[model samples]
Target chain A: MDLAEVKRIGALARLDLGEEETAAMSDQLTRILDYVAQLEALDTTGVEPTTHPVTLGEAFRDDAVRPSLPTEAALANAPATDGASFIVPRIL
Target chain B: MAADSDLARLTLHEARDRVTAGEVTSAELTEACVARIEEVEGSVHAFAHRTTDEALAQAAARDAARPDPLPPLWGLPIAVKDNICTQGLPTTCGSKLLANFRPVYDSFVARRLEEAGAVILGKANMDEFAMGSSCENSALGPTHNPHDLERVPGGSSGGSAAAVAADECLAALGSDTGGSIRQPACFCGVVGLKPTYGRVSRNGLVAFASSLDQIGPLTKDARDAALLLGVIAGHDPDDSTSACQPVPNYEAALEAEVAGLTIGIPKEYFGGGLDPAVEEAVRAAIATYESLGATTVEVSLPHTEQAVATYYLVATAEASSNLGRFDGIRYGVRQEGKDLLDVYKRTREEGFGAEVKRRIMLGTFALSAGYYDAYYGKAMAVRTLIRNDFDAAFGQCDLLLTPTAPTPPFRLGEKLDDPLTMYLSDIFTIAVSLAGLPAVSFPTGTTAAGLPLGAQLIGRHFDEARLLAMVHAFEATGQGRPLPAL
Candidate 1:
């Protein structure tokens, strides 16, 4: 909820909130975090957690080849694109 | 029938009959639907975009080019949840990140519907990235329940439910990840089906939690629901997660009697927090089903308490990863700055809403190297236990019945400021997501305040036929009859 915590969370989320936005979001997020934190107070100590509401398996499908959109169609809306894929600024 | 309300009252089958009989042309039906949208949509906020021209054009073509008798659902106007990609139409998932991004190809379900001659009415609003149970997180605005303008239509698929409830469209497609489809259907007083995961391909759905997401129908009646499901459900070679199970004729199961079926009533669902009115309605629904010849039995799903925590961890983690593609370099929103990192930072900072950022952060924290085992890994283990609980329960009973939500729809902004309360709106629904089983919600009745109440019926994995049969029987008994308030 503090600036430091906000910065840490932003980093973890792969986001970069500016100083002003960070401070604002920190306050807003603090309220939510505080509310969600109440879940910890519940006595789920002996309770086993539930991951799904219904029972099922890994739900895997067989790998098969299907038609892919041609490069022109696939990159139709790309702001910038190379011959076969998207082009972007150098990360380094 | 008043054009303003005629389209709203007609079921998909009825609409199809009229179109085929020349009582109403597809263009007339489409115009009526568009006019209905124009009238009530200001209050309901169900549609994110209204394709009046496109819908009418499609309907006109359906009427003009009918070289043979119309197919089932031919010329019917149906809405699509914004999360499903429609070629040339913006598929925003109610997020700023993809607000302007349009796909070049439609999702399998979207393509299938078009092939079946259903006119694309428009796209309905939803939670940002389909992350929240309440539609409150939508970048546009909260979708109001049609019965009452003040209350929320249960979400991540609130728009679809509201659109159907308000008669904006004959039926709409909704995606269910932790009860996104069923919960809102309950809140809005309509029928929402979450077909067994994989029964419907997830190929073009914008992923929230990939493993749990399934596209289903939100319709005015069970038979319409079956028709919609029949068109949407099937194996798709394009999706690696698509199920190979045969898609049964759901309509054939519609009139099937549930005389000898076993319905399980879990004690946990009727516990302390359930609203008195909701409890009464769901119990009455169960009693009605019993009178129809189905036997009721008490069953236990012991690992119920930890569902919320486990769901958050797993869903957030998967969402965190699935959403990673939204950097400025991708297909949607882009915020310019001096350099690459700045672009990433600026785009995300401006694109994601407060709730989305919160989940991404929590998911990142859970998936972090040091905490993965304590959080995400542990959550997975707990998910297995929950699945096992359902498996054991299914052995004792054919299907499980419970209230769709603890309470009926609350006012739109009531829980907006309280995140936990909003999250808890999905408590009854998340367990079904975790177990990856099929469930549906149908109207039970109304609360004293006049909002709709709904009940949840869950079936064994890949047993959507049985689930639909049960819903069909319930619908026949009129237990889920829509109230007169709306």
Candidate 2:
């Protein structure tokens, strides 16, 4: 809940937090964590975590080549797209 | 027998019947709804985008194709939640990030509704990324309650509920992840149904918590909800979790008798946090059920108190992972930066609202290396116990009845500043979502202030038909309320 802790978490989440926003978040996260800390009192011995409500095995598609969204449609919503590909800042 | 001004007030089933019988044309219904929207949208602020020309054109197409056997929802104008993608309309999800983004493909629910001959009206407003309890979290601005402009319409599907309550649209599609649909319906005094997990396909819904989110209808009555659910529910190969179970004739199911049914009144739901008036109204609703020959029994969901904390942990953890896809590289608005990492950070910071950012940070903290087991891992285990609570309770009752929310809708901005207080509003409705059960919120009565109070009916998984039937019977008792004065 400290400023440094907020900064670390923001970095991990890839969010750029303002100083004011970070201060507010630190206080709020602390309050929320304290509230949720009640769960620590419960005994969850040997209980399986439920990732999802229903159990389903891996989904397999037909493996047939089907028509996909045309390149233009795929890139239609991109903010900066060259005609053929999304234009992102240099990664290297 | 009613004037065009009253056409917008007709339930979805009524409109469908009139259109199918040729007594009224889709153009007339569409024009009536358009006029209603025009009259109220300024105050209600329910829509993020309106599709007048497209709706009229679609209505015209339906009129021209009066096939021998008409579709179930022929010519009915329905609203879609902004979070659900529409092929040509802007699907903002009530965030600055996707404010101007339009999907190239319709979501599975939208596609199904279109194929069922429903005329798409527009996208209704919701909380940003369906993250908050009140519609106040919408980046566009909050949607006000139709009953009183000063009060908030409960959200993240607030606009959908408010629009239905105001008669701006016959019914609307809303997504519920931890009570988004039901809470708003309670506040707005309408019928909201969250079907079982995988009851409706989620292929086009903007993911919040992938496991908990489901598309549902906020309607004027249970019959309309059943009609809309029938049109939208079925197996979709596109959604891996969409169940392959045979879709029941929900409209037909509404005719079933309520006698000899066992209804459970959960002791936990009526405890300390519940408002006295809401408790009275909901208990009266149970009395009405009892008068109709239904048996009532007390049941306990011991883990009910932990639902909010558990929901935040599980939902935010999923949200953190799901929202990671919104980085500046692929879609929506992006802020340019010197480097890719800067682009990601700046775009997210600029695009997401405070609540969204708070959740992302909380989720990140939960899923962080040292804290994962204590928060996210423990929450998942608690979620299992919560689900098991419902399973055991259902063994004794056909349906579980409770108040939809702790209190009636409060004034706008009342709880906006405090996120925890806002989260507490959905305490009654969140557990059903966590258990992946189907539940409906219907107006049972109104508070002294004239705002509506709703009662919830939670059913076994995939038991929406039974839930709708019970609601229909309750509606048949001459207790179903009408639209609020705007």
Candidate 3:
């Protein structure tokens, strides 16, 4: 991956990398990606790719009323809160 | 304490006795621990955040307070892996995104420790978002093995392992999704227990893989580990995923007799890629157990080799979704830019480390349409096979034994350049996680270089008490090795 691609991936990850970090990460990630790409070369046509190694099913609780975190406490550490609601900058 | 002084080496029970008898105040102990950190952390880099003043203040208050008559862990100094949150300390998970983010609430385990009068020392370093097998992926820097400064401590719980080995803390808490705690504990020659999933609450723990993630104890020995587990384990109403099961007296379980027990040795564990030294150490440990009247049965976890691949896919997918909240407007670091999109992009670009980004992309790609069934769905099916492998084996024996890792601690930067080599570190560890079983890594012997070698004992679901008894039996045989000289 190029530095620009690194910057793009970092952007997608919601990070702020400096020029030096971008350059370094680009090189490091390139090698890692190249290694992962080896998985693509395998004959996975007949073989299935594994996701979770444990034999488990979906983990969801029944929809029932339970005590929830109070609004003030829930949003206490939110970076931007306005009147008990998280205030996010508008899209576009 | 001198730099080489092993004064911080006292067991949790011994330290608590000293504090309660007025021989040493909690402040004195915390100071000694902090002093050890100052003496050795420069080379070890075990901690991500050190709360010296906070810990000392808490320790002093604990010293002055009336007795609560709680379990043995009261007033013990403890380090928590950065993935588990503390109210005032930075809960970074060794990732840049949450590097400066402080949780307003404590995890269930942290709160329980405080109620039990244990001092929270600080947050220990880990792999970024607990994604890597080694702490090398940490946004800050790598945590070196206390036994050999040139070698990695093993991770994403490496910091906790190193701290325990260096006498920085009596005990610590680390999360294991795929051997994050056990592998590092093995590498550092400390005791690490990955309790059965849902055994501990994940409320304040940064999630990597929800189904598999478990918060556990890393200590100097099995008895100390049991003490910490006694304080931390059990159900929390806040975490619905936590098991609604009774918390047994783990310490009492330690004294339980272990005669006529059956231990399984999976043939798969002794397969290719295992270092001969590790194999030798593991066999010696098993023989010690056999001497304790335990019989070993050769078993198989046939799908064990596929665990790493399946884990990466499932864990990465969950990590990608879990980390999606840090888009510059929520709980962590933000970087301002021209517009809302630019702001989001730049913040993430600067905040997340490379390893975090790589997992996110890999996970996102795997979960994306047209690939989900082939990658994720298939992996889940394979997971069932792996779990069945354990199910079939446990029917024949009470517990399974394996080397915690294929090799001992590797030199720093040895596998940092290759994700495959790094991923292989979890080869032995991930299988237990895949099977959703409880496993603990205890020091069994030393490598040729005198680094600690550990053997892992995997127990049936919710059978940690039995595992503890078995390990205690082995430890009794004098095979429970001590820390290596740094």
Candidate 4:
């Protein structure tokens, strides 16, 4: 929960942080983790992790091609989109 | 015998009956809600987006086609939480990131409501990305409690609850990940039901924690809650997690008696951190239930202390994964940067608020290499134990009764600076969400300050019918549905 740790986690989460934010996050994350550290007191041995409360068997859809959103609708919310394609910063 | 002009005061069930009997037109009902919203929107700040024209048009259409058998929600003007997608309307989710983003299609819940002939009043404000306990986390602005203007309406569904309490709409939809709907309903003096997970489809809800988030109703009373739940609950092919079980007639289930029911009071919920007034009010509610011939017993949930920690881990981990879609590529606001990586980092950094960033960072750290087992994995295991605790308690009783929140609504910005203190606001309501059980928060009494106090009734999974029945029976005692003096 140090400044370096905060910065590393922020970067890993795809967020850019200022120096002050990083420092504040370090303290806050440390406190939260310290609180969370209480979980270590419990013995969770031989317990199965519950990912989702409702247990559903495998579901398969009919794999039918249905009507989808038109291209205009699909690109309606895009920040930067050509008529038929999205525009982004160059990769290489 | 409320007049057409006083349609806002009618419960969803009453309004539906009147509309079916031709006593009032949907246009008049929509006008009443619109006028109410116009009168109070300045103080309450409940709605993020108001759709007056669309609502009126929908109402006019409903009036034109007076079908033989009316739809369940016919002519009711209901507000939707901003996180649930609505076609052709801005679904901001109370964040700058999606400030003007309108979806191309309606969410499953919205579509069902529309098919049932409900008038879409507007989108209600909420915590940014449904993340905080108080509505103060909303980037647009915080919503004020209808009971007291200075105090906050609890969140992240604060606006929905406030609107229902203030009579801006007949009822509203709210998504609960961790007490978002129930706590706000408790604060605003309304009935909020969080149906069992997978009981309602989540096809288009903006995911915070997918497993824990279920859309439910915030209404003036328990019967209204049942009516709205019936309209929205059921399986959806679009949502794979939706249960394929037959949907029950929840409104009909409300007529059943609760004479022989056994309600458990979890001892842990009454301990430290509980305000005396809130505890006393909830205890009085339990006594009323006892007088109605329902038995009460003390139960234990030993892992209660670990729920907040486990919820944070599991919810944040899922949020981090789900929110990665908002990288400025497909939709939402984008900030141009030097490179693609820079675009993502800059967009997210500028778009998300502090609380969201803190959660994303925490999730990233927990799920990162070498730390997953110690943090996220352990949290999942502890979650099992927490669910087991509820199962064991329910085995002893039919329902668990407790205070919805540990305290009454505080002043705005009271706990905004301290994140841990804010997280503790969901202390009593989080375990039920983790267990994916059905629960409702109904008003028990008002505090000396006149703010509402609520008691929660938790039932076994998929047993919402019984829970609604118990709440309806309690409502018949004249203690439920206290309207704020707005």
C-alpha DockQ of every model:
0.35, 0.81, 0.30, 0.87
**Could you tell which candidate, 2 or 3, scores higher by TM-score?**
2
Interface RMSD per candidate: 3.8, 1.0, 4.2, 0.8
- Calculate each model's fnat, 2 decimals: 0.39, 0.78, 0.37, 0.87
Arrange candidates by DockQ, descending.
4, 2, 1, 3
Q: What's model 1's overall lDDT? A: 0.83
Task: State the weakest 10-residue window (summed lDDT) of model 4 chain B.
Answer: B1-10
**lDDT string, candidate 4, B1-486, tens digits:** 455448898899988998998888899999999999998999999998899999999999999987778889887899999999999988989988988799899999999998899999999999999999988888899999999999999999999999999999999999999999999999999999999999999999999999899999999988898899999999899999998878899989998878898999999999988999999998888888899999999999989989999999999999999899989988899999999999999999999999999899888888999999999999999999999999899889999999999999999989999999899899999989999999999998899989999999999889998988888888888886667788
Give the TM-scores of the predictions, in the order they appear. Answer: 0.92, 0.99, 0.89, 0.99
Candidate 4: true contacts recovered, fraction:
0.87
**What's the alpha carbon RMSD for model 1?**
3.2
Q: Write the per-residue lDDT of candidate 2 for residues B197-243, one digit (tens) a residue.
A: 99999999999999999999999999999999998999888899988
Alpha carbon RMSD to native, model 2: 1.0
Q: Which of the CAPRI classes, incorrect, acceptable, medium or high, describes model 1?
A: acceptable
TM-score of chain A of each: 0.73, 0.91, 0.71, 0.92
Off by over 4 Å in 1: A1-6, A18-67, A81-87, B1-4, B67-69, B483-486
Which tens-of-lDDT digit does each residue in B105-125 have in candidate 3? Answer: 888888988888898899999
